[model samples]
Target: MTAMRSPFRDALTTALLLTAAVAIVAAIGTQLSGGTQRIIIDAMIKMIIVLGMYIFVGNSGLLSFGHIGFLGLGAYTAAWLTIPPSIKASLMPGLPDFLATAALHPLPAALAGGAAASLAALLVGIPLTRLAGVAASIGTFAMLVVFYAIFSNWTSVTGGQGSLYGLPVFTSLPVAAGFTVATILGAAMYQASASGFRLRGSREDAVAAQASGIDIRRERLIAFVISAFFVGVAGALYAHFLQVVVAREFYLKLTFITVAMLVIGGMRSLSGAVAGTAFVAFLSEVLRQAERGIDLGVVSIGGRLGLQEVGLAIAMLIVLIFRPRGITGGRELTLGWRSR
Candidate 1:
């Protein structure tokens, strides 16, 4: 049977398409306030993370608990490349012979970081893919922990707990929006590719897919690399976006937030990526604002407690209780035009 397209799907797709367009135009429009600009920028960065999720989790039905490692890898890679060569020598002594010898441009550095992350994922994916079910899950989690440990301990390269600062902030709203567009198109293309189909097949039933001549390990690795690459890109943006890079930024907690986006949006769906990211991203902000408490002028309370903890718990509860399959439930963004 052909893939069914519901009205809801059409509407969701159209809305996101319009949003991408509007964001692009706005990016080119007159400069926006810093806070407003930051919101859009944050959304765009999150777009990359969500798209990465859509690739591996969506196509292959794999749940990676440590995908943030790619973000860490990308951030560190970019930091090393983009940082002033003089700064590098002082910060990262006894580094890779090539790194010490070579200097990098921002664009090239971003590409290199993405490539490095994908390569790293490839190496790691080989052995990890051999395990099935929860074994794979735990293996990946361990991988994340290991990566975090390395980042924390590898002072010279990553700068350890201290933030990697002094990155020239080249990431503007327009650039971020462009990246978001690219991310959407890339994820869409991956979803429709032959390899994607094979990966999905393996995801649905690895044994059956193997019987049909599919190399599950190869397929998983491919997905892992692709996902890692995008996540790496997201890391580049995040480093520049915050004007710094830190190990904690890509820890298990970041993984949890990203996983929440995938799970609440619906695993194995492109539309779900957008849906989950939009809803979760926006909701998180709202909860944060609520926790912070709006200024009434008359009085203000709840200063001692940050709403983030409670907000996160509530968000998790809402998703698990009401919409278990996630908000999108594996849908696609199509044509549902709504005028404001």
Candidate 2:
């Protein structure tokens, strides 16, 4: 007799596959050079961020260009909580009394950062979520611009354009892999939940969903907050991973790469998010290595400037042209023996 298929079963299968793949990569990355390990960390971080994105964009069928703003908020909030009081005083003397004096552990700081981003999302989503289609996308983009402008000029708090340093480097490959696994599980559970299904239904047809009594705004806002919490956690991890924070790191270039990852991986599925992240990460690492010079005894490739961006853009264009739904074609990964 065959066991009955359920959302939990499907989620478990997908989560296990994603976790296993990342764990394997982590094990292999441990044997590689420091530079290569850094690449792996970068990839895992992108996985976290993209999965957070999948929670929102994948289920809602909405494109958000401003989620990076939440990422920045989380990073800075975590930085404020974790940096030493003395360093904080020097860099951001204008911090509130509590923030200026309170130096917390990484775990607390990460939690606080996630909470901060979720709060920001709630406030922003209230109005932005009310809009739909291009207008909604523009509203979110505007929010990102607002975040950038504020962080860029808020020298007393954000250090303006300067890099904020002295953060503890605690995000090892294993640590990142652990987070990636958790993120994968969380994304899968959410995607299989009733809320996720309703949001997707609304995405399919707003009018029909509304006629069915589904509150689109509420669903979108819920997703927005949940996604922000994870993205914010990714930011905290990123801050500790790099031991630095800069407003610019959460800006346009980062946004483009992350969004591209989602689009290329198949924004509709959790597997797509993971695959896209790994694919783009591998391509990016190779391109960067080539830019440094890849020697092949007889001849060498790379040592060229600006090739990484050019290569990535070309690859993305090719994928879009040929596989517009992305590498996974918007389908979830499943074991052949498992029930669909």
Candidate 3:
């Protein structure tokens, strides 16, 4: 018989299922109120970011606390390119003459964001990917801190913690859904490709992979740049979705949530990325509603301001304790039977 197509088949199934879930969310959002649709967009954006993280962290077996820095990079680049020149001149006068005067469509803005993030990743990955284990993770975390500081304090360029508003609201449910699907397909393809295989081999045993002629750093850096670009796309989408760009929005808070989603979903497989994002996003929405007080026919419960964070923390802890492999147990989704 010909070589079995299990892996590729499984990857396609996983991508399709992931796309299906996003489509369902988009459909449901269209049927619901505007606020609900906004929530769906937010969730899909998170899905894209988490999937982007998986493209590197999952394949390379590296924990990155710094991809959110790429998110900030993408967000700011999109703001610079896409925001109206008049608004840019008034709010971000520190922007370069070219950027301040340039206004672009959403596609170009997103591409610019991705390119900027990928460039940053290329520079950082050279040094960072050289390290291994916890050291690499810490280095990435430091990167995030550096980005946060710059964006927070760069008054002219980033609005200095003030929200940069008037971004053209271009990310509707369809746009968000399309981005999510593209991210899923891109990640799945990379995961099943030769580079992904070599990277995973390096991840499992760097010494062996190195002995086998695989340049560990090169592979890791490739994944890093690719992942950064995808996350940057998510950031651009987010900027347009909210019609604003704020430093704090792309900082630690979001970093924590995206990381949690990945961990709870399973960092080993693409399906885990999708499952984790959907699970956490749905849970988050529920907790948000609960915090705002859900009305049970007979009684109106008062809102609990911090419940969302508290619930997330508790859920993460429980999942870590019970299912450290995540909801998908690090397994890829498959269309046909997948023999153990």
- List the global CA lDDT of all models: 0.77, 0.89, 0.90
The collision pairs in model 1 are 13-333, 13-334, 58-268
Candidate 1 residues lying further than 4 Å off, grouped into runs, are: 1-31, 336-340
Candidate 3 — what's its lDDT?
Answer: 0.90
Ranking by TM-score: 3, 2, 1
The order of the candidates by lDDT, greatest first, is 3, 2, 1
How high is the lDDT of residue 133 in model 1?
Answer: 79
TM-score of every candidate relative to the true structure: 0.88, 0.95, 0.96
- Among these predicted structures, which one has the highest lDDT? 3
Cα displacement (Å) at residue 177, model 2: 0.8
lDDT by residue for model 2 (1-340), tens: 1343477787889889879888999999999999889889988988999999999999998899998998898899889988998999999978998998988888778878889999999999999889999998889899999999998899998899998888887789998999899999999988888899899999999999999999999999999999999999989989998899998898988898898899989988899999998889888888878888889999877588777788879888998999998989887788853422
Q: Model 3 segments beyond 4 Å from truth?
A: 4-6, 337-340
lDDT of 1: 0.77
- Candidate 1 TM-score, C-alpha based: 0.88
Worst 10 residues of 3 by lDDT: 1-10
**Candidate 3 lDDT by residue in tens digits, 239-293:** 9988888898877889989999999999998888988988999999899889899
Worst 10 residues of 1 by lDDT: 1-10
